[model samples]
Target chain A: MATTENGPGALEPRPAPPKEQRFSLNAIQELEEIASHYPERKAACLPALWIAQREYGGYLTPAAIQEVADRLGMSYAEVEGVATFYTMYNLRPRGRHHLEVCTCLTCAVMGAYDVVHELERALGIEVGGTTRDGEFTLSEVECLDYCGAATVVQVGDRYFTHVTADNVLNLIEELRQSEEYTPVKLADAIVKLHLPGSSQTGGGSRTGEQIRNNELY
Target chain B: MGIRNLLFEHRDVENIQDIAVYEKHGGYRGLKKAVKMERSAVIEEIKTSGLRGRGGAGFPTGIKWSGIPQNDDKPHYIICNADEGEPGTYKDRELMLKLPHLLVEGMIIAGYALRGTAGYIYIRGEYVEPAWQVRKAIDQAYRAGYLGKNILGVKGFNFDLYIHMGAGSYECGEESALMSSLMGERGQPRLKFPHAPYPTVEGVWKSPTLINNVETFCAAAKILDMGGAEYARLGTERSKGTKIFSVSGHVARPANYEVEMGTPLMELIEAAGGVVGGALKAVIPGGSSVQIVRAEDCPRVNLDYESCQQNGTLLGSGGFMVFNDRTDIVLLMKRTAEFYMHESCGKCTPCREGTRWIYKILDRITSGGGQPGDVELLLDICSQIDGRSYCGLGDAAAWPIVGAIKAFREEFDYWIAHKRSPVGPGHVPPTPEVVNPLLTLVPA
Candidate 1:
């Protein structure tokens, strides 16, 4: 079946994991805290996937899914199914500064097409393809609930609203340089990576240890 | 008669999320007032206020609370539907980002009324800032004694709220799907039998749960403070209270506007700083799922449920997507259909296949391969998908094609006749300046 080249990389099969590793101590600690909030262990599925997406660079890997499944006492297929069902859980890899342009009704009409086209032209790839420098991958997604900010371009955790085609290139360069992301990481900037609950109660848990950043996951 | 701004009253005020600032401006006053009131009285107030769910389905909020069985053995849950993913909607995002306490306060009151011990704000993953702000507000509320084991030192009334993130399934905005996603499963909507329990009766963990919109919860708190009867006086007969419309696209000033219900459709557009280039082509009165009406026929339309329904469109999630004369109807319909097609959970056959088929046909026609009978086929497919699929999404997949063809069949037919849209590429418009904070301008 020929997939429409509309949204970048939707129909393409997700890449297989290169290797496997257990969740880091901090990730386990965070997952345990999140798991405590729910009545069932499975309810922590989205949160676990979020941690994996952050720990791994911008995508989920099969190994990470298995680790999450193991932690939640669910089958790999079950976790994978839950992970793949969500659009935010990227099965394949995304670039360093993953950029998504909202191309739904509001943004599409409000210059989203132009934004995507410009991003593609600037990056020298179509919507689904990634840049050779591994800096950006442009994809058009559904609404982000920021419709008023038409042509809403989401990069990591930041939403750059109302970006036109004319300024998108500059916007990309700016976003690539944009700092501070979500999905709690291990570092001195632990405030950005502070897991909910009492992981930072003592003010001494800033181990400055980075989570293993597997590029290919 | 005029714009009514309740939810967005302090939208532009800095540090509104800070508990001190919010309370100083009467933030938790509703929660404080409701806490001392009897549990039944809180529910009674919401019932009297006539506040309907601001989520797509205009279900009465007070009546929804009345459905939950209080003495049920299982503990009750209160889920805040913060996953505002409907195309052309962003009002909840602002409410959560700017005024997070309103949601927290609303949840506390609603949970207290239903005897719900736990609450969750199921926010969409794409909403990075709103979610963070909400989490911070939750912490603030906990520290301020507005939440937790004994709020205001009131015993036997325990309500704990947590913020959860959804990866990205637009269907999760639906209560059942949201529960499924919450319980670590694929977010698919369950079939509802008449006698069978709803989320309020048999929801997550098979317990009675109440899910309300961010705006609904905020309005609940506001209703409690303003007194139910006073709140009921606003809006039309059925649609009460001021609604926050996320006005976007083809407008000089596209932003969130809170207007009294039953405001004329043209008036809301004017409130959003009027049409760009001083011309209007069409208006999607609601979100993408509702009908798309032409600008020529919009004056008869009002920003209420009854008026939109009378005009052959429903005021479903006031995500107003306005289009100007420079826009292309074919492309809009195509994109709208394409969205539902992509978001379909594939649980049902009709919607799963029908949406894609309709999109492909539109794709062919819009790309200049349109043959005769394509429009009829699209309409036929839309009818098949509508009312046939299990959930509202399946029915929603039909609206884009049905509404577009209904209002602008000739324009769609024009694409088929010409084998291409008259409005083509290289005609990308400029972005309207997005105001950082959507506040109504008060002339000094």
Candidate 2:
């Protein structure tokens, strides 16, 4: 599947999904609310898809694309065209855990190439290729623009920087072994900033006081 | 650091922002010279010199000038794109704040070269001081007979200048979107096809117009004065002339450096204080949209468009952001993705939906939601958004998310597996609010 260098595959672009499959009622209501922010319905496509992709998983199943189109009052083709154009909208099923490596110039210069190769070796899949166990899929992408730190990778919503091949290998093994890990609370994570007047000091510290604790915001 | 002398030698009587100070420093000399030359000669000179646009695209400025229809009947508009919104980008603001007349002079030269009578400088609203400086300069120019009607006794070529403000949309940085905003419409990009049309043939009001970046216009005066060959000698073969790079991130000195194109990257880092005493992890050679270059990748990379393209990154606006050893790729993804998601114009589906989808995947992965198949899912989503969006914004928005995953998968794997950042997550960093809402609050 990855034999081709780049560009579209041999198959013609697929027809858009049917109207009913575009979205569910629950998502439609939310999209309508997002549409209110912009005068043009087209402008809501991004925000709507953000919510829709969350509801539909990694890929924008044909039905999900159609639903976004229907909600935005745009044609299925327009919606499909947009979905297929960007690298973010997934068109296929993916593993339960996704890993993003920053190959932007900065990361690449910082031995990101080796990090990518390490993941491929660990998962037995090429960049942009999925693993047989559906546990990890890896791909190369542009800069995350966190030039303050290189060798950065994003897993889920969190960012990990200053990474190496060894760091990645161990991390992958830990993830595969740990089934009890759960997401940290956003509010708790956010509260660790220790605002000047705020009373919370050690009240909400999660584990290691990291970037979330720094009040860059 | 006090007025680099080349651009400020004569203009340092006081501050260039004031008309009196600028006039004392031979401010309108370029305009004066420009008024005497035929428009054809000015355009020819620029084209021959091979000066390119300074606003990242690096398209030859003279060719753009020549693209305008010479015999067009419609009124031509000339605009200066001053909406410098790229994060880690601030060179335009520095130019405007220190050398307002340089910009005005550049605009005059560009207007003459393009035969435009009506011109505007679209200033970003957030930059109040620079906007004020430009406004003052234009008023000064009008008073000194540099703008409006015939200038310096040049007959039949009248010029008028105006200042237009943008409503804080990064999309406006795109040329088409900038045109839409200039026309009082929402700042959304239009379809670009065929040979990039000369703006003068079909620009603002569907008439012939020439829209140039602030830096591009400013470079015009210098290029005309030096001639094309002299100007070409400064930069590399393909990328001619000096480029103003906005240096930021983990460095001792985070300021703008105007250097000849193709200068080595390691030199820039060293000049900026050599990574601030920490491990040099990565470097963003261009604005946030360009691919990130890892520290090891910096040896051969030069600060020019051709070099960047050859190296798989781009010299996008020269907005360099540096990262150190402490930075987390996942945090970078979330922050950048969140920015794209917030700023997404929702014009096309790929960018609109794709941005958010990646953000969610990154969010879940970083938040300790380690599913077995998450990585494959992420790669698949990125492939869908790569070339499918309607505008570059979609591609711009998606690059950081996908790139982070590509270069730093292990960090992500660690977060998913450990339920904490692989670097040791405790609390998320707080984002800074640059604009003060309280400043707008008036006492009752």
Candidate 3:
């Protein structure tokens, strides 16, 4: 296949890991279960690729995605197309903490632009740029379905809604102090980085933790 | 109650797509039974089943099918609304994945009942797996004489099925929009005048067309197989048979579940292993479009269409999204409104401008800049949007915000009066003004 100027990644491929770590038992188990939904194992290619990308930090390399396609009994081209289509799946290497700021229509209207700009400045990297420390990567995505809390940003699995420019500094400070700042689960990371001056329950029980704390009302 | 998992049971296996497996499991029994009966009898059987459309609208399926012109020389068409664009709803995809032949069987029976020759399943673009399964099933049906010329040995009755893929657009879920898309045009909905005698009489290239959801047709097939009265016995009088609900969000188990029509809301949450790591705060009863219910009030409701209607909500597409205390309801509504606005086809000014305006107003309010009279302003915009737009999309776009305001007035008031969200800070509350909250202005 000829690589056209408009090809998916005009940039050169990033260097691969010394020896690709084989997929862990848990990752394979998860992939197998998701693949069980369809009559064919190949149907789970996209979701399996997503899980694989998370396991290898934030970005997904062509080699990694192809590995997923192979494991799920699909062609590499099919997995590549799905990876490029969705903005949520990162195709390149990102920082340790891949904080996605939703800049979709709702978030945009709710001051997400300000949060994005502020976060980028605080992290000392551009929107799609990774930090020198390789600790954080900021990117803008479409809807994450958290429209009610406009200006929502998710570091790993956790989301911080009602986010503001002033609150970005405190979020960074929290990330720096905590040894458990590693964002393995996106939802859990969002719950951990509470903005300063927020309600003691942090966003007043909007955290999944609060839901578990019986502060449901 | 038999609670027959006929459609959903045994989802995994190689080449269930093969006709042999389908036949061995009593698959075409309904079609064979219907083959011997008159078309009118088939329609009557569906009518007696009390089955309703599963494509969000909940209209009676048999009544809609019966309204079509039977004697017309023009070709009557049957369309399956597999464009499952409603967020949090994936039951149609699940059905097509689990039992593709059931849909084919139902469509064949329906094609025969309506005196139709062709049918199309307008599948969503994102559903790669389900679409492939349906296409394979259609092919198998052709090979087995279940589709194409003279379906299943019923000579001289030619009915063909085609699979049309939609390009990731939610608007195509609308009937007129779907018809336009099938004709290869941009999917802006056409204006419909009330008392026009439902689209079954005039649809899809202006010939009588019957559009039913994938699950709805499968339910119809179940009715034919189980006997109409027997199927009707499973649900409330107004809404019969089992309903497939796509449960997502803060549930411990976020999967699709099929339940009898009148099952209580609490039973559903329990089935999904309770809320995921939190106290349940709210429930979006039917996708993100219909009115939301607080967790306290959810126990009083049932899964039937009538119950939803009586409770000022809808049994819409059976997409039940659970939200815990962690979810900000205001932000949730804003996101949903934004989806409707973005997907709006911009055909009518009321819908086009109204959805944008609603998003803008809600955006400003939730962003902590809401004005004191913004509540009235928001209500006014929604009222103008409701019933004034060309298609049901506009009304769908407007309903959630209206219902949310009516049900959660205090939450909106707290945001407006305190310059902060009742739930958290960094929320720019709307401007405070001394406005009365009790003036009830009924929607037009």
RMSD of each: 8.8, 16.7, 14.4
TM (B chain), model 3:
0.92
Top candidate, metric TM-score: 1
Point out where model 3 deviates above 4 Å. Answer: A1-217, B1-6, B10-15, B193-197, B425-444
> Model 3's lDDT to the true fold?
0.69
Instruction: For residues A1-217, write the lDDT of model 2, one tens digit per residue.
Output: 3335346666544543554553556656655654543335675565455455666655567778777777667777776665554344456665655576765434543566678778877788876666887777675544443444557675543456677887888778766785521121211121111111121233221211221232211
Candidate 2, residues B118-176, lDDT tens digits: the string is 77777654444455556656766777778878777887778777665553467777888
lDDT of predicted model 1:
0.77
User: Which residue runs of candidate 1 sit more than 4 Å off their true CA positions?
Assistant: A1-19, A176-217, B422-444
Error of 3 at B85 (Å): 1.0
Candidate 1 docking classification:
acceptable
Tell me, by DockQ, which candidate is best: 1
lDDT string for model 1 (B1-444, tens) is 557888778766667777798898888888888888988888999999988889989999998998889777788999999889888888898787678888999999987888887998888877756666677778778888888887888887888888778877899997888888888899998867564677777888988889999999999989988999999899889888888888988788887889999999999888888898547988987798998998889999988889899999988898898887778788777777778878888889998899789878877887778989998898888889888887889898898678888888887788888865565543323221221111111100
lDDT of 1 at A32: 88
lDDT of 3 by residue, A37-74 (tens): 33346535545655666576555766777677678766
Predicted candidate 3 versus true structure: per-residue lDDT over B252-359, tens digit per residue: 766677888888988888888888656888887787678988877898899888888888899897777777665556666776677777677777899889988887
Best by lDDT: 1
Candidate 1's TM-score: 0.90
- Looking at model 1 chain B, report the run of 10 residues with the lowest lDDT sum: B435-444
